[model samples]
Target chain A: MRKGGVVVRDVDSEVLQEVVVLRFLRNLFRRKDTVEYLREAWRTKPSIAVAEKLFHRLQDTGSPGAALAFIREAGRAYPHAQRLRDLQHQALRVRSSEEVKSLRAALAANPRPEIYARLGELYRYLGHCEEALEIAREGIARYPQSGGNYLAIGLVHYSRFLKTSSAHDGLQTEACLRQAYALDSASFKSLYYLACLYVYAGAKPMASECIARLAELMPGDNRVADLAQRAQALPDSPQGTAADYFRLHEARAMEAAAGAPGRAEPFAGLRPGKPLNDRLARIAALPGVDGVCVLDRYGARIAGAGRSGDTACNEAALQGMLEGARVNARRMSIGNFSRAVLRSKDWQVFLYELEPYGLAVMGGRTARQDLVQRKVTEFIEECLCEEQGA
Target chain B: MKRILKELNRTAGIRGSMVMTQDGIMVAAALGPDLVEDVVAALASALLTTVKRSFNQIAAGESLSELVLTATDGKMVFLDLGNAYLVVVAKRDLALASTMVEIQSAAHRIKNRRASTVQRQTAAAR
Candidate 1:
């Protein structure tokens, strides 16, 4: 039998009979008791079909949080169930929209500073930059001393700065964040954003000061430590903008989703169109390029082409080199480790951090480093574009 | 040797300079107040040791002539000498192309100084 678009085979007859009874009860009474019964049935039987039905019933009953929880649990148990994951994402979007609507209603009924700040932050998270800015401006106009509104404004401009790399946006971000910090020196968010801004702007002294303040505030916090490490490893010339950073993170999340035993069409736009190996192969074919490989943070080869005969050994060595560089860079408080060039008599090896993955390209010593760097940039851009278009 | 490091430290944006063995032992250092001599030496040694091991594992009979690590806040350049490595730490804005000349010159002077000292020891023994 087909129910809720999920095939109902392999289900026990007793369970199916119970589900039928619950459906009848739901249709007749539409009571909370019916939902309880469905939940009980799901907990007892725990089949994919039942889980889907339970999720729909939960949503109908206006318990999206419960529905999301159930769907996520089902997703983990039945990793092959793409339908559940889709429903989960759908539920999240619906829930967020519903909350937004309610929050808007609440603000319309009674305008308040916190609400405006919150709405602005929500809009920012949703990538509604204009709306976020508008809301934050409203909040600032009413509650000029509210650091939250200033932070929201700063973040919107920071996101814009990341996207546009405009000097004005950068300046606006700095000004807003500085105002926020001045309003509340002990605010963790304020300090964190200031530190991130300084680090990106290559203002090492300012970045270091903010980081030091954060360390004092949260002495044992791992995030503070991570921030410190990032400060040390920052590249001399930081590249990419907010869009690039978010896209890479989104791509990684989708990759994890793809790993589950299900179709990943929901994230099709962010999935890579071509296999990474094919892309690496194209890079290897570049003139004077000896080899190319992508290694995970741990140094495991994710993909490669034109590698030497001792691929395993070479990968291990590369991993070791990356680790050492990362450690040293952090200890020195440089920024964040971006890239390194290893030179020998016969070859030059370039290693780049692509966040969760690292790209290593080996080229003959005769190759123009600038040309090789350009090719690598092209390859990275292609990967990002393919992911966005896929 | 210390004088060479001190001179190298004078270069714009260079915070400190040091000479260390592949094993992480500090021979000499001219570091800024913000830098600790022991910490810098230890870190440099650890990095060089790892790089050297990587080269050995490849077994390609190739030795690293130079390594440059560029971070967001600063940059470190390592030049291989026969017996020790010269490690220089500078700010991110360090004009590497222009500053490398002075750095290389300082490395050369250190190498020459070591060579002369070895020669003097050999002559004394004879």
Candidate 2:
């Protein structure tokens, strides 16, 4: 026999007969009998084609879970099969969609707080932030005392905060989680999320308090322990009270919201001209400085001095580090990440965040830290002044 | 080892201190009520791993020597001690010049003590 342009060796007669019967039954619209026989055939002598057909039949018969289970089993049996892997992925997506459809239908039939929370969580997990936020907010409006909706809201905002590093999102996440905690202090999910938020925000004392409480609630839970460990590693939020940090960020957010062209958009109008390039070159020429590059928020090189290739490479690397640093800083509820000095035995890289742009200065190990810092600070101030003046 | 950390913590503006292997295993720690030893060790290790990886990519062969993260709330100083590291958690207003001297002294003493103990162990085996 030939299959998909490939010659196949002689097949087992019994297996072939079973496939023939299964195909005939499926053709006659005997899906139930066909699935039964397919299952029996699979147990007796499993084949990829038979498993695929069975999976389709099961899915058509409204048994997604069984279809998924059978497909997974087939996947395990044929670990190297790309077709099975694809089918498995398809089954998962189908299952999730079906679940959402059913949940929505049920919710329409009878709106409930728990249903709203579940659907919101599902939407959030699916990356539908707007829908998740809407559903969560709706749930909150209907069931003002329910902590689950607040948790859903907090989680959605937390994910947004992670992506945008927006202090506004972080503050919203904190507020929602805090409200959730207040509604039910002993709730494990609320405490866990609250602990996680504190750890990220670099609120050590607060995280510790949450972790301690969680420990009391559930002794020896690995999650609590892991959280406890993470809380230990939190960098101190740059010197400021949490209130002060949030207030500063809030004011900046407000400014941005009001179309004030806040610090983050300082160079919105000014293109990278010769003067800017000259300034970068001068910074690069400073004693011990090897290279200097300015990068826009999107990690695009705005202006700098160096071999183009080297600058691009440095820009990509520095941008990634800068992003990581920004997220970390925001997580810790630190107002803003102004600068970082990364030193190794042979090199020292200074990174500065000038709102809309990032500045990277590469230097030798012997670079005078104080001089480099002062010059960079002065250079950045000068650029901002020039841009603002322009 | 704890004594060394305790001594280091006595420095003004230093909130707490710990000595841990490069992988973040706690060797010794002298911390205040606000600090937890295992948590600090794990957190330090996690941060070091990230910093070391980032540094390697930027400057291929050079190993990180020190990492000083000055955040709004406080400062954390991580000093490389060959196989181990010294992590000092200090107030943001810490006098870097004076506090670093104490931290370096503590790190040196830890290294010396380890060396002497290894030498003594070699002699006993012989």
| DockQ, all candidates in order | 0.34, 0.14
Q: What docking grade applies to model 2?
A: incorrect
Error of 1 at B3 (Å): 2.2
Query: What is the Å distance of residue B94 in model 1 from its true position?
Result: 2.1
Candidate 1's residue-wise lDDT over A324-346, tens digit each? Answer: 77777887788667678888887
State the lDDT of candidate 2 residue by residue for A41-108, as single tens digits.
88998889888889998998899999999999999999866456656756866776677799999999
* Model 1 misplaced stretches (Cα beyond 4 Å): A1-275, A385-390
Error in Å for residue A357 of model 1: 0.8
Error of 2 at A329 (Å): 4.8
Candidate 1 lDDT, tens digit per residue, B9-125?
Answer: 888889999998877788899989988988888888888888767865653768887888887578999998878989999987676778989989998999999999999999999
Q: What's the TM-score, to 2 decimals, of chain B in model 1?
A: 0.94
Best by DockQ: 1
How far off is residue A347 in model 2, in Å? 1.4
| Alpha-carbon local distance difference test for all models | 0.75, 0.74
* Model 2 lDDT at residue B82: 79
